[model samples]
Target: MSGLEGCWSAPGQVRGKDATSVLRGEWHLGRRYFVLHLRSVAPAQAYEAAITYRAGEKPGGIGSFWMDTFGGLYEPSLGLGAVSPDGFYLDYHFPDAAYHNRFERRGKGWRWTIVERAPGKPDKLFARYELAPASCRGTTFTF
Candidate 1:
């Protein structure tokens, strides 16, 4: 996790439209864990989420907690995550939506992909946010 203790930016497109997202991660509780704040920037749009990472649920366990703005918009979908050597995975269950997310730090950036699976339907790509150190801000993105 220490390798990711900084800010990253994902300037890409969503639904064929320009989009931007920034992720800031920092150590918490005397470096016992990490808290990541995710923010999105787009014209007349906003999104936010937080992920809490706790090291070693057991001997080699990495646990995570995920919650997002969906709950604030009238749907509470608190989620949990598991991490392997490759990356982290999160699964959420909501009354109306099922979401699965995977994050992998590759080479110099993080690959964040999310999928939405609705009842009686196939899984669909919700979004894929690729994050890397935004050089303009010395590896950080300015709000």
Candidate 2:
């Protein structure tokens, strides 16, 4: 609730067959509200999303990510298991796979990475991100 706390947006395209252009909007650390807005570049199709984070005493918040397109429920968690000199760690879960999230800041933008981890197998999936300055960009402090 300290560093990456604000409204951020970016112009990005989802990797898929029915590719859709999206503008990711995030509201951090104030009232714990997060959202991702999407717009179809092919036409005038558009949708707005609102995701709320439930507060709890556990390492991660048990919640789900629902998209505006098809109303798919995604399991998302904000946990404290990740401890490093780089940044804070959290986990994002979907119906098919689970991902380990690392939010780290470098220069004017932040690099967010995700590693896929199944229930029984060792975590190995890797997805890297380099966010623009207009997005959430800053250093993370460790205790």
Candidate 3:
């Protein structure tokens, strides 16, 4: 996961697309987690958020803490993830809402996607994040 440390730009953002978002993070809590910050801006709206990701006690699972700018929208959600041979799967299930996400390796970069599912319904893609290396962040996202 050390490869995850650094600045990442979304697709079509090489020309400055704050609306598309730019993500950056570093490790914190004595290497317990990678503290991430994201900023997004558009013509009439803007958003910012932070996330903390930590490896779980076992080999297949991970945990995250998230908080965003939305007023009480997400507040702080504790998310869980599982690792596989190809990539990682994350599920963020809050009351009345559920999201399934995937972070898969794509060459030197990564592909991140999320989908929302309602009870007895099909999954709907909420967002897709294509992260590519923008700059090296020292050595690791380590604290």
Clashes found in each candidate (C-alpha, N, C closer than 3 A): 1, 2, 1
Q: Ten-residue segment with the worst summed lDDT in candidate 2?
A: 134-143
Strongest candidate by lDDT:
1
Off by over 4 Å in 2: 5-70, 73-85, 94-96, 119-122, 135-143
- In model 1, the runs with Cα more than 4 Å from the true position are 13-16, 56-62, 73-76, 135-143
lDDT, each prediction: 0.72, 0.46, 0.71
How big is the RMSD of model 2?
Answer: 8.1
* Positional deviation of residue 12's Cα in model 1 after best superposition, in angstroms: 3.4
> What is the full ranking by lDDT, best candidate first?
1, 3, 2
**TM-scores of all candidate predictions against the true structure:** 0.76, 0.48, 0.81
Candidate 2 lDDT over 1-143, as tens digits, reads 23444434333333222333323454656656544333334555454444333334454433334334445444233333433466556566665567776667766555656688777777774655455544334421110
| TM-score quality measure for candidate 1 | 0.76
- The candidate that wins on TM-score is 3
lDDT of 3 by residue, 1-143 (tens): 56677788765232233347667867877887787676663536466678778887788788887787774866688888888676777788877768777778999888877778778777777777788887644423211
